[model samples]
Target: MSTPATSRARGVERIIDIFRQLHAARRPMTMRELIVATGAPRSSIYELVAIFSEAGWLETSGDGSVFFGREMHYFGADYAAHNDLISRAHQSILSLVRKHDETAQLCTLEGNKYTVMLSESSSRPFNISSDIGVKVPIPWTATGRLLLGHLNVNEIRALIPDEDFVLENGTRIAFDDFLRDVQYADAQGYCCTEGLSHTFRLCMAAPIRDRSGVAVAALCFMTSRDTDPKKRELMLDDLIKSAKALSEPYSRL
Candidate 1:
């Protein structure tokens, strides 16, 4: 037994679902695509998109494709500037880049995924590729292990549905082993993973906490395993210092 008001509310929710789909796609979408994606009628798709566009929540291109509008970006940037745990830590990130001469990355845990929000590439001839705006499974990366430290083993396993963690290059870590490594990282105050992606690549990561003392992100550096021992120790020292420095600004936000 549903009232007319309840049915109308359900219809509005469906429209909102469609809007979220467009926003997540991060590109212009056609009405036909929206209809298919939302499973809404063509008329309903046009009606909803028109309403969103009129309110400046969506913008349509000359080709009749639609995307999230400038308003969304403006609002997102505003929220990110204030809410972003990484932007507040920029000074520390910059220091690490300058001190180590290797690329540094700032990664945050967003639900179950690890997203690289900012990174500074090394000035050296060889450095890892820019990882900004990339998402990696939390168990498959050094930074991911640090991010997982915020959660207990059972919580981490619940977040990741797969039984095993796999790298892009066909390397894999069993779930039990991955959990053990995360526990080890928690004990060590940092995480180190070698050859997860490339054969000789090495990565070190430390967690960054917000004002509430919750580990919100991981500051990580990638380099070759063959890096000179003296240089590696110096870099690790800087990384730890930077992590502490970054934690200070986070309290302000």
Candidate 2:
């Protein structure tokens, strides 16, 4: 038995799941598909969909498929405009994109995962396609490893689940090894990992620390694995500079 408040809360949570599934699919979803994806009752799903559709948060296609409405873009744009970090980071990321001709991203930890907050794609023929807002296992990302720099060995251990190390590509990094990466990033103030997530590219990340010196986010750069060692080192240096630029303003906030 659930109260009205709990029922409303459940619906809100379910709505988020609906959007997540839709985004993951990168296309519209039918009501039946949403019901299966969300594991929600059919009636509740229908009602929620109707509410969102009417409010312009969602839109239905002619074939009865639902997708993000134009209004959702408005909300996202409005949010980006207001968030100081996103605005500031976007400028820094674009500079990297222009200079290095490689993808630049700002990522943050979310639970046991990391989500790309913003990205500027490279103008080169090949680029890393990191979809913004997609959450991936923390252990699978170089940024994820370094983002844990703020936490201690025990806290990091508690925060990351054992299963996360078994990447989608079937590689299982030992906990001790992963812990060492965190410790190294913490001590060295930056990190670069190649082929841990995407086999074709390398990622370099540095902490964007807050006033309290806690890392709230990461600024990262992606480059081809074929890059010469000297150029890779230079790109990594630029990434560290960009991260510092973003972190400095936040240090006052």
Candidate 3:
């Protein structure tokens, strides 16, 4: 027996699901595709789509494909403008890329996964960049270690799915090794890893702490594995300084 309130909540969840599916697809979807993706009844989905379209939350293309409307962009822009961490991180990464000529990113945990909140790409002929908002396994990134610094071993084990330990190359990372890395990152205030997510890439990350000294986000650089050791060390030092600056309240200015 669902009350009206519960029913309305369920409808809201379904609407969110629709948006998530569309974003994950990274493309416009048709009515039939929306039904299959959201698992909502055809009539209900159609009604919701119509209402959203009228409200400028969604739009239909000439081909009848549905996608986010201009209103969604406005909403996202407003969020970015108001979010202090993201706003500051965006500028920081731009500076980092200009100084180091390497891809720089601001990353954070999204549930059990790691996600790039913002990215600035390098202008070098060969560079690596991650898709913003795409979620990846925690074990697949150097930033993942620093992001999990506040969690105990048991909490980390419980948070990460078992299959996430397997690397893209079919190598499985032992839980003990992952725990060791997390502890080291916590102690050192920074972390670096090579060839975890990509065979030819290296990542260096430093934690952006909150007032409580817990890592709320990570600032990172991704460069080729063949980068000079001295350059890598310099980048890591810069990352640590920048992360420390961003953590302080006055740094937001």
Candidate 4:
């Protein structure tokens, strides 16, 4: 038997599930599509959609495909405004984009995976796409390595699954090498990698530590693998300085 409170909580979970599916799809979806994707009962889907639509939390297209409503944008905007790290990091990342004309990211660890909570893409013809809102395996990113600097070797080994060592390009990273990278990052306070996630992209990352000096997140930028050596060095210097600037807000946090 379920209480009324329990039933209401489940209803909220269903609503969140629908929102997750829509966010992952990144496009309007019809009723049938939502049903197939969510695997929820048809009646529940209909009722939930109707309620959300009426409340301006969802909207339907002319073709009856459903998407997020203006209210969701308003909610998201409010969240961005009040989030301390995001508000501070957003300005720092934009400055990096203007300075180096490269894609800059604010990355944090979500469990064992990495998330680009915020990103500013470059205007160059051969720019890299920052994997914002995508949960990627830790070994797939330089930022992940730097972010793991906060953890001990034992904690890191326990957290990352063995299968996560396999990259999208079919390369297998040795655990010993990954551990060494983490140790190096912890010592140096930064790290850089080339041809990890994509063959033509290079990444540079620095730590954003909390008041206790644990690296809660990373500040990173991506450059072309073919970038000039001298220019890359200059960009790295600018990035390290910008990373420090971003870290200043930690005391308040």
Task: Find the candidate with the highest lDDT and give its number.
Answer: 3
Best by TM-score: 3
User: Scored by CA lDDT, what does every candidate get?
Assistant: 0.75, 0.86, 0.92, 0.86
Q: Model 3 residue 68 lDDT?
A: 95
TM-score of each: 0.76, 0.94, 0.94, 0.92
* Candidate 4 TM-score, true structure as reference: 0.92
When sorted by TM-score, best at the front, the candidate numbers are: 3, 2, 4, 1
Give per-residue CA lDDT, model 4, range 149-176, as digits (tens). 7677788899999989999889999999
Clashing pairs in 3: none
* Residue-level lDDT tens digits of model 1 in 142-218: 87776676677678878985833777777678888888888788778788788776678888888776676666677
lDDT of 2 by residue, 1-253 (tens): 9999998899889989999899988889999999999999999989988999999999999999999999999999998888888888889988888887888899988788888989888877778768888888898888887778777778988988889888768989999999898888888988888787788878888889887777889898877788888888888898888888887764221
Error of 1 at 154 (Å): 3.0
Candidate 3 regions with alpha-carbon error over 4 angstroms = 250-253
Worst 10 residues of 1 by lDDT: 244-253
* Candidate 3 per-residue C-alpha lDDT over 57-113 given as tens digits, one digit per residue, 9 for 90 to 100: 999998989999999999999988988888988899999999999999999889999
**lDDT for model 4, on a 0 to 1 scale?**
0.86
Model 2: colliding residue pairs: none
Global lDDT for candidate 2? 0.86
Residue 66 in candidate 2, Cα distance off native in Å: 0.8
What is the alpha-carbon lDDT of model 3 when measured against the actual structure?
A: 0.92
Q: After the best TM-score superposition of candidate 2, give how far the Cα of residue 162 lies from its true spot, in angstroms.
A: 1.0
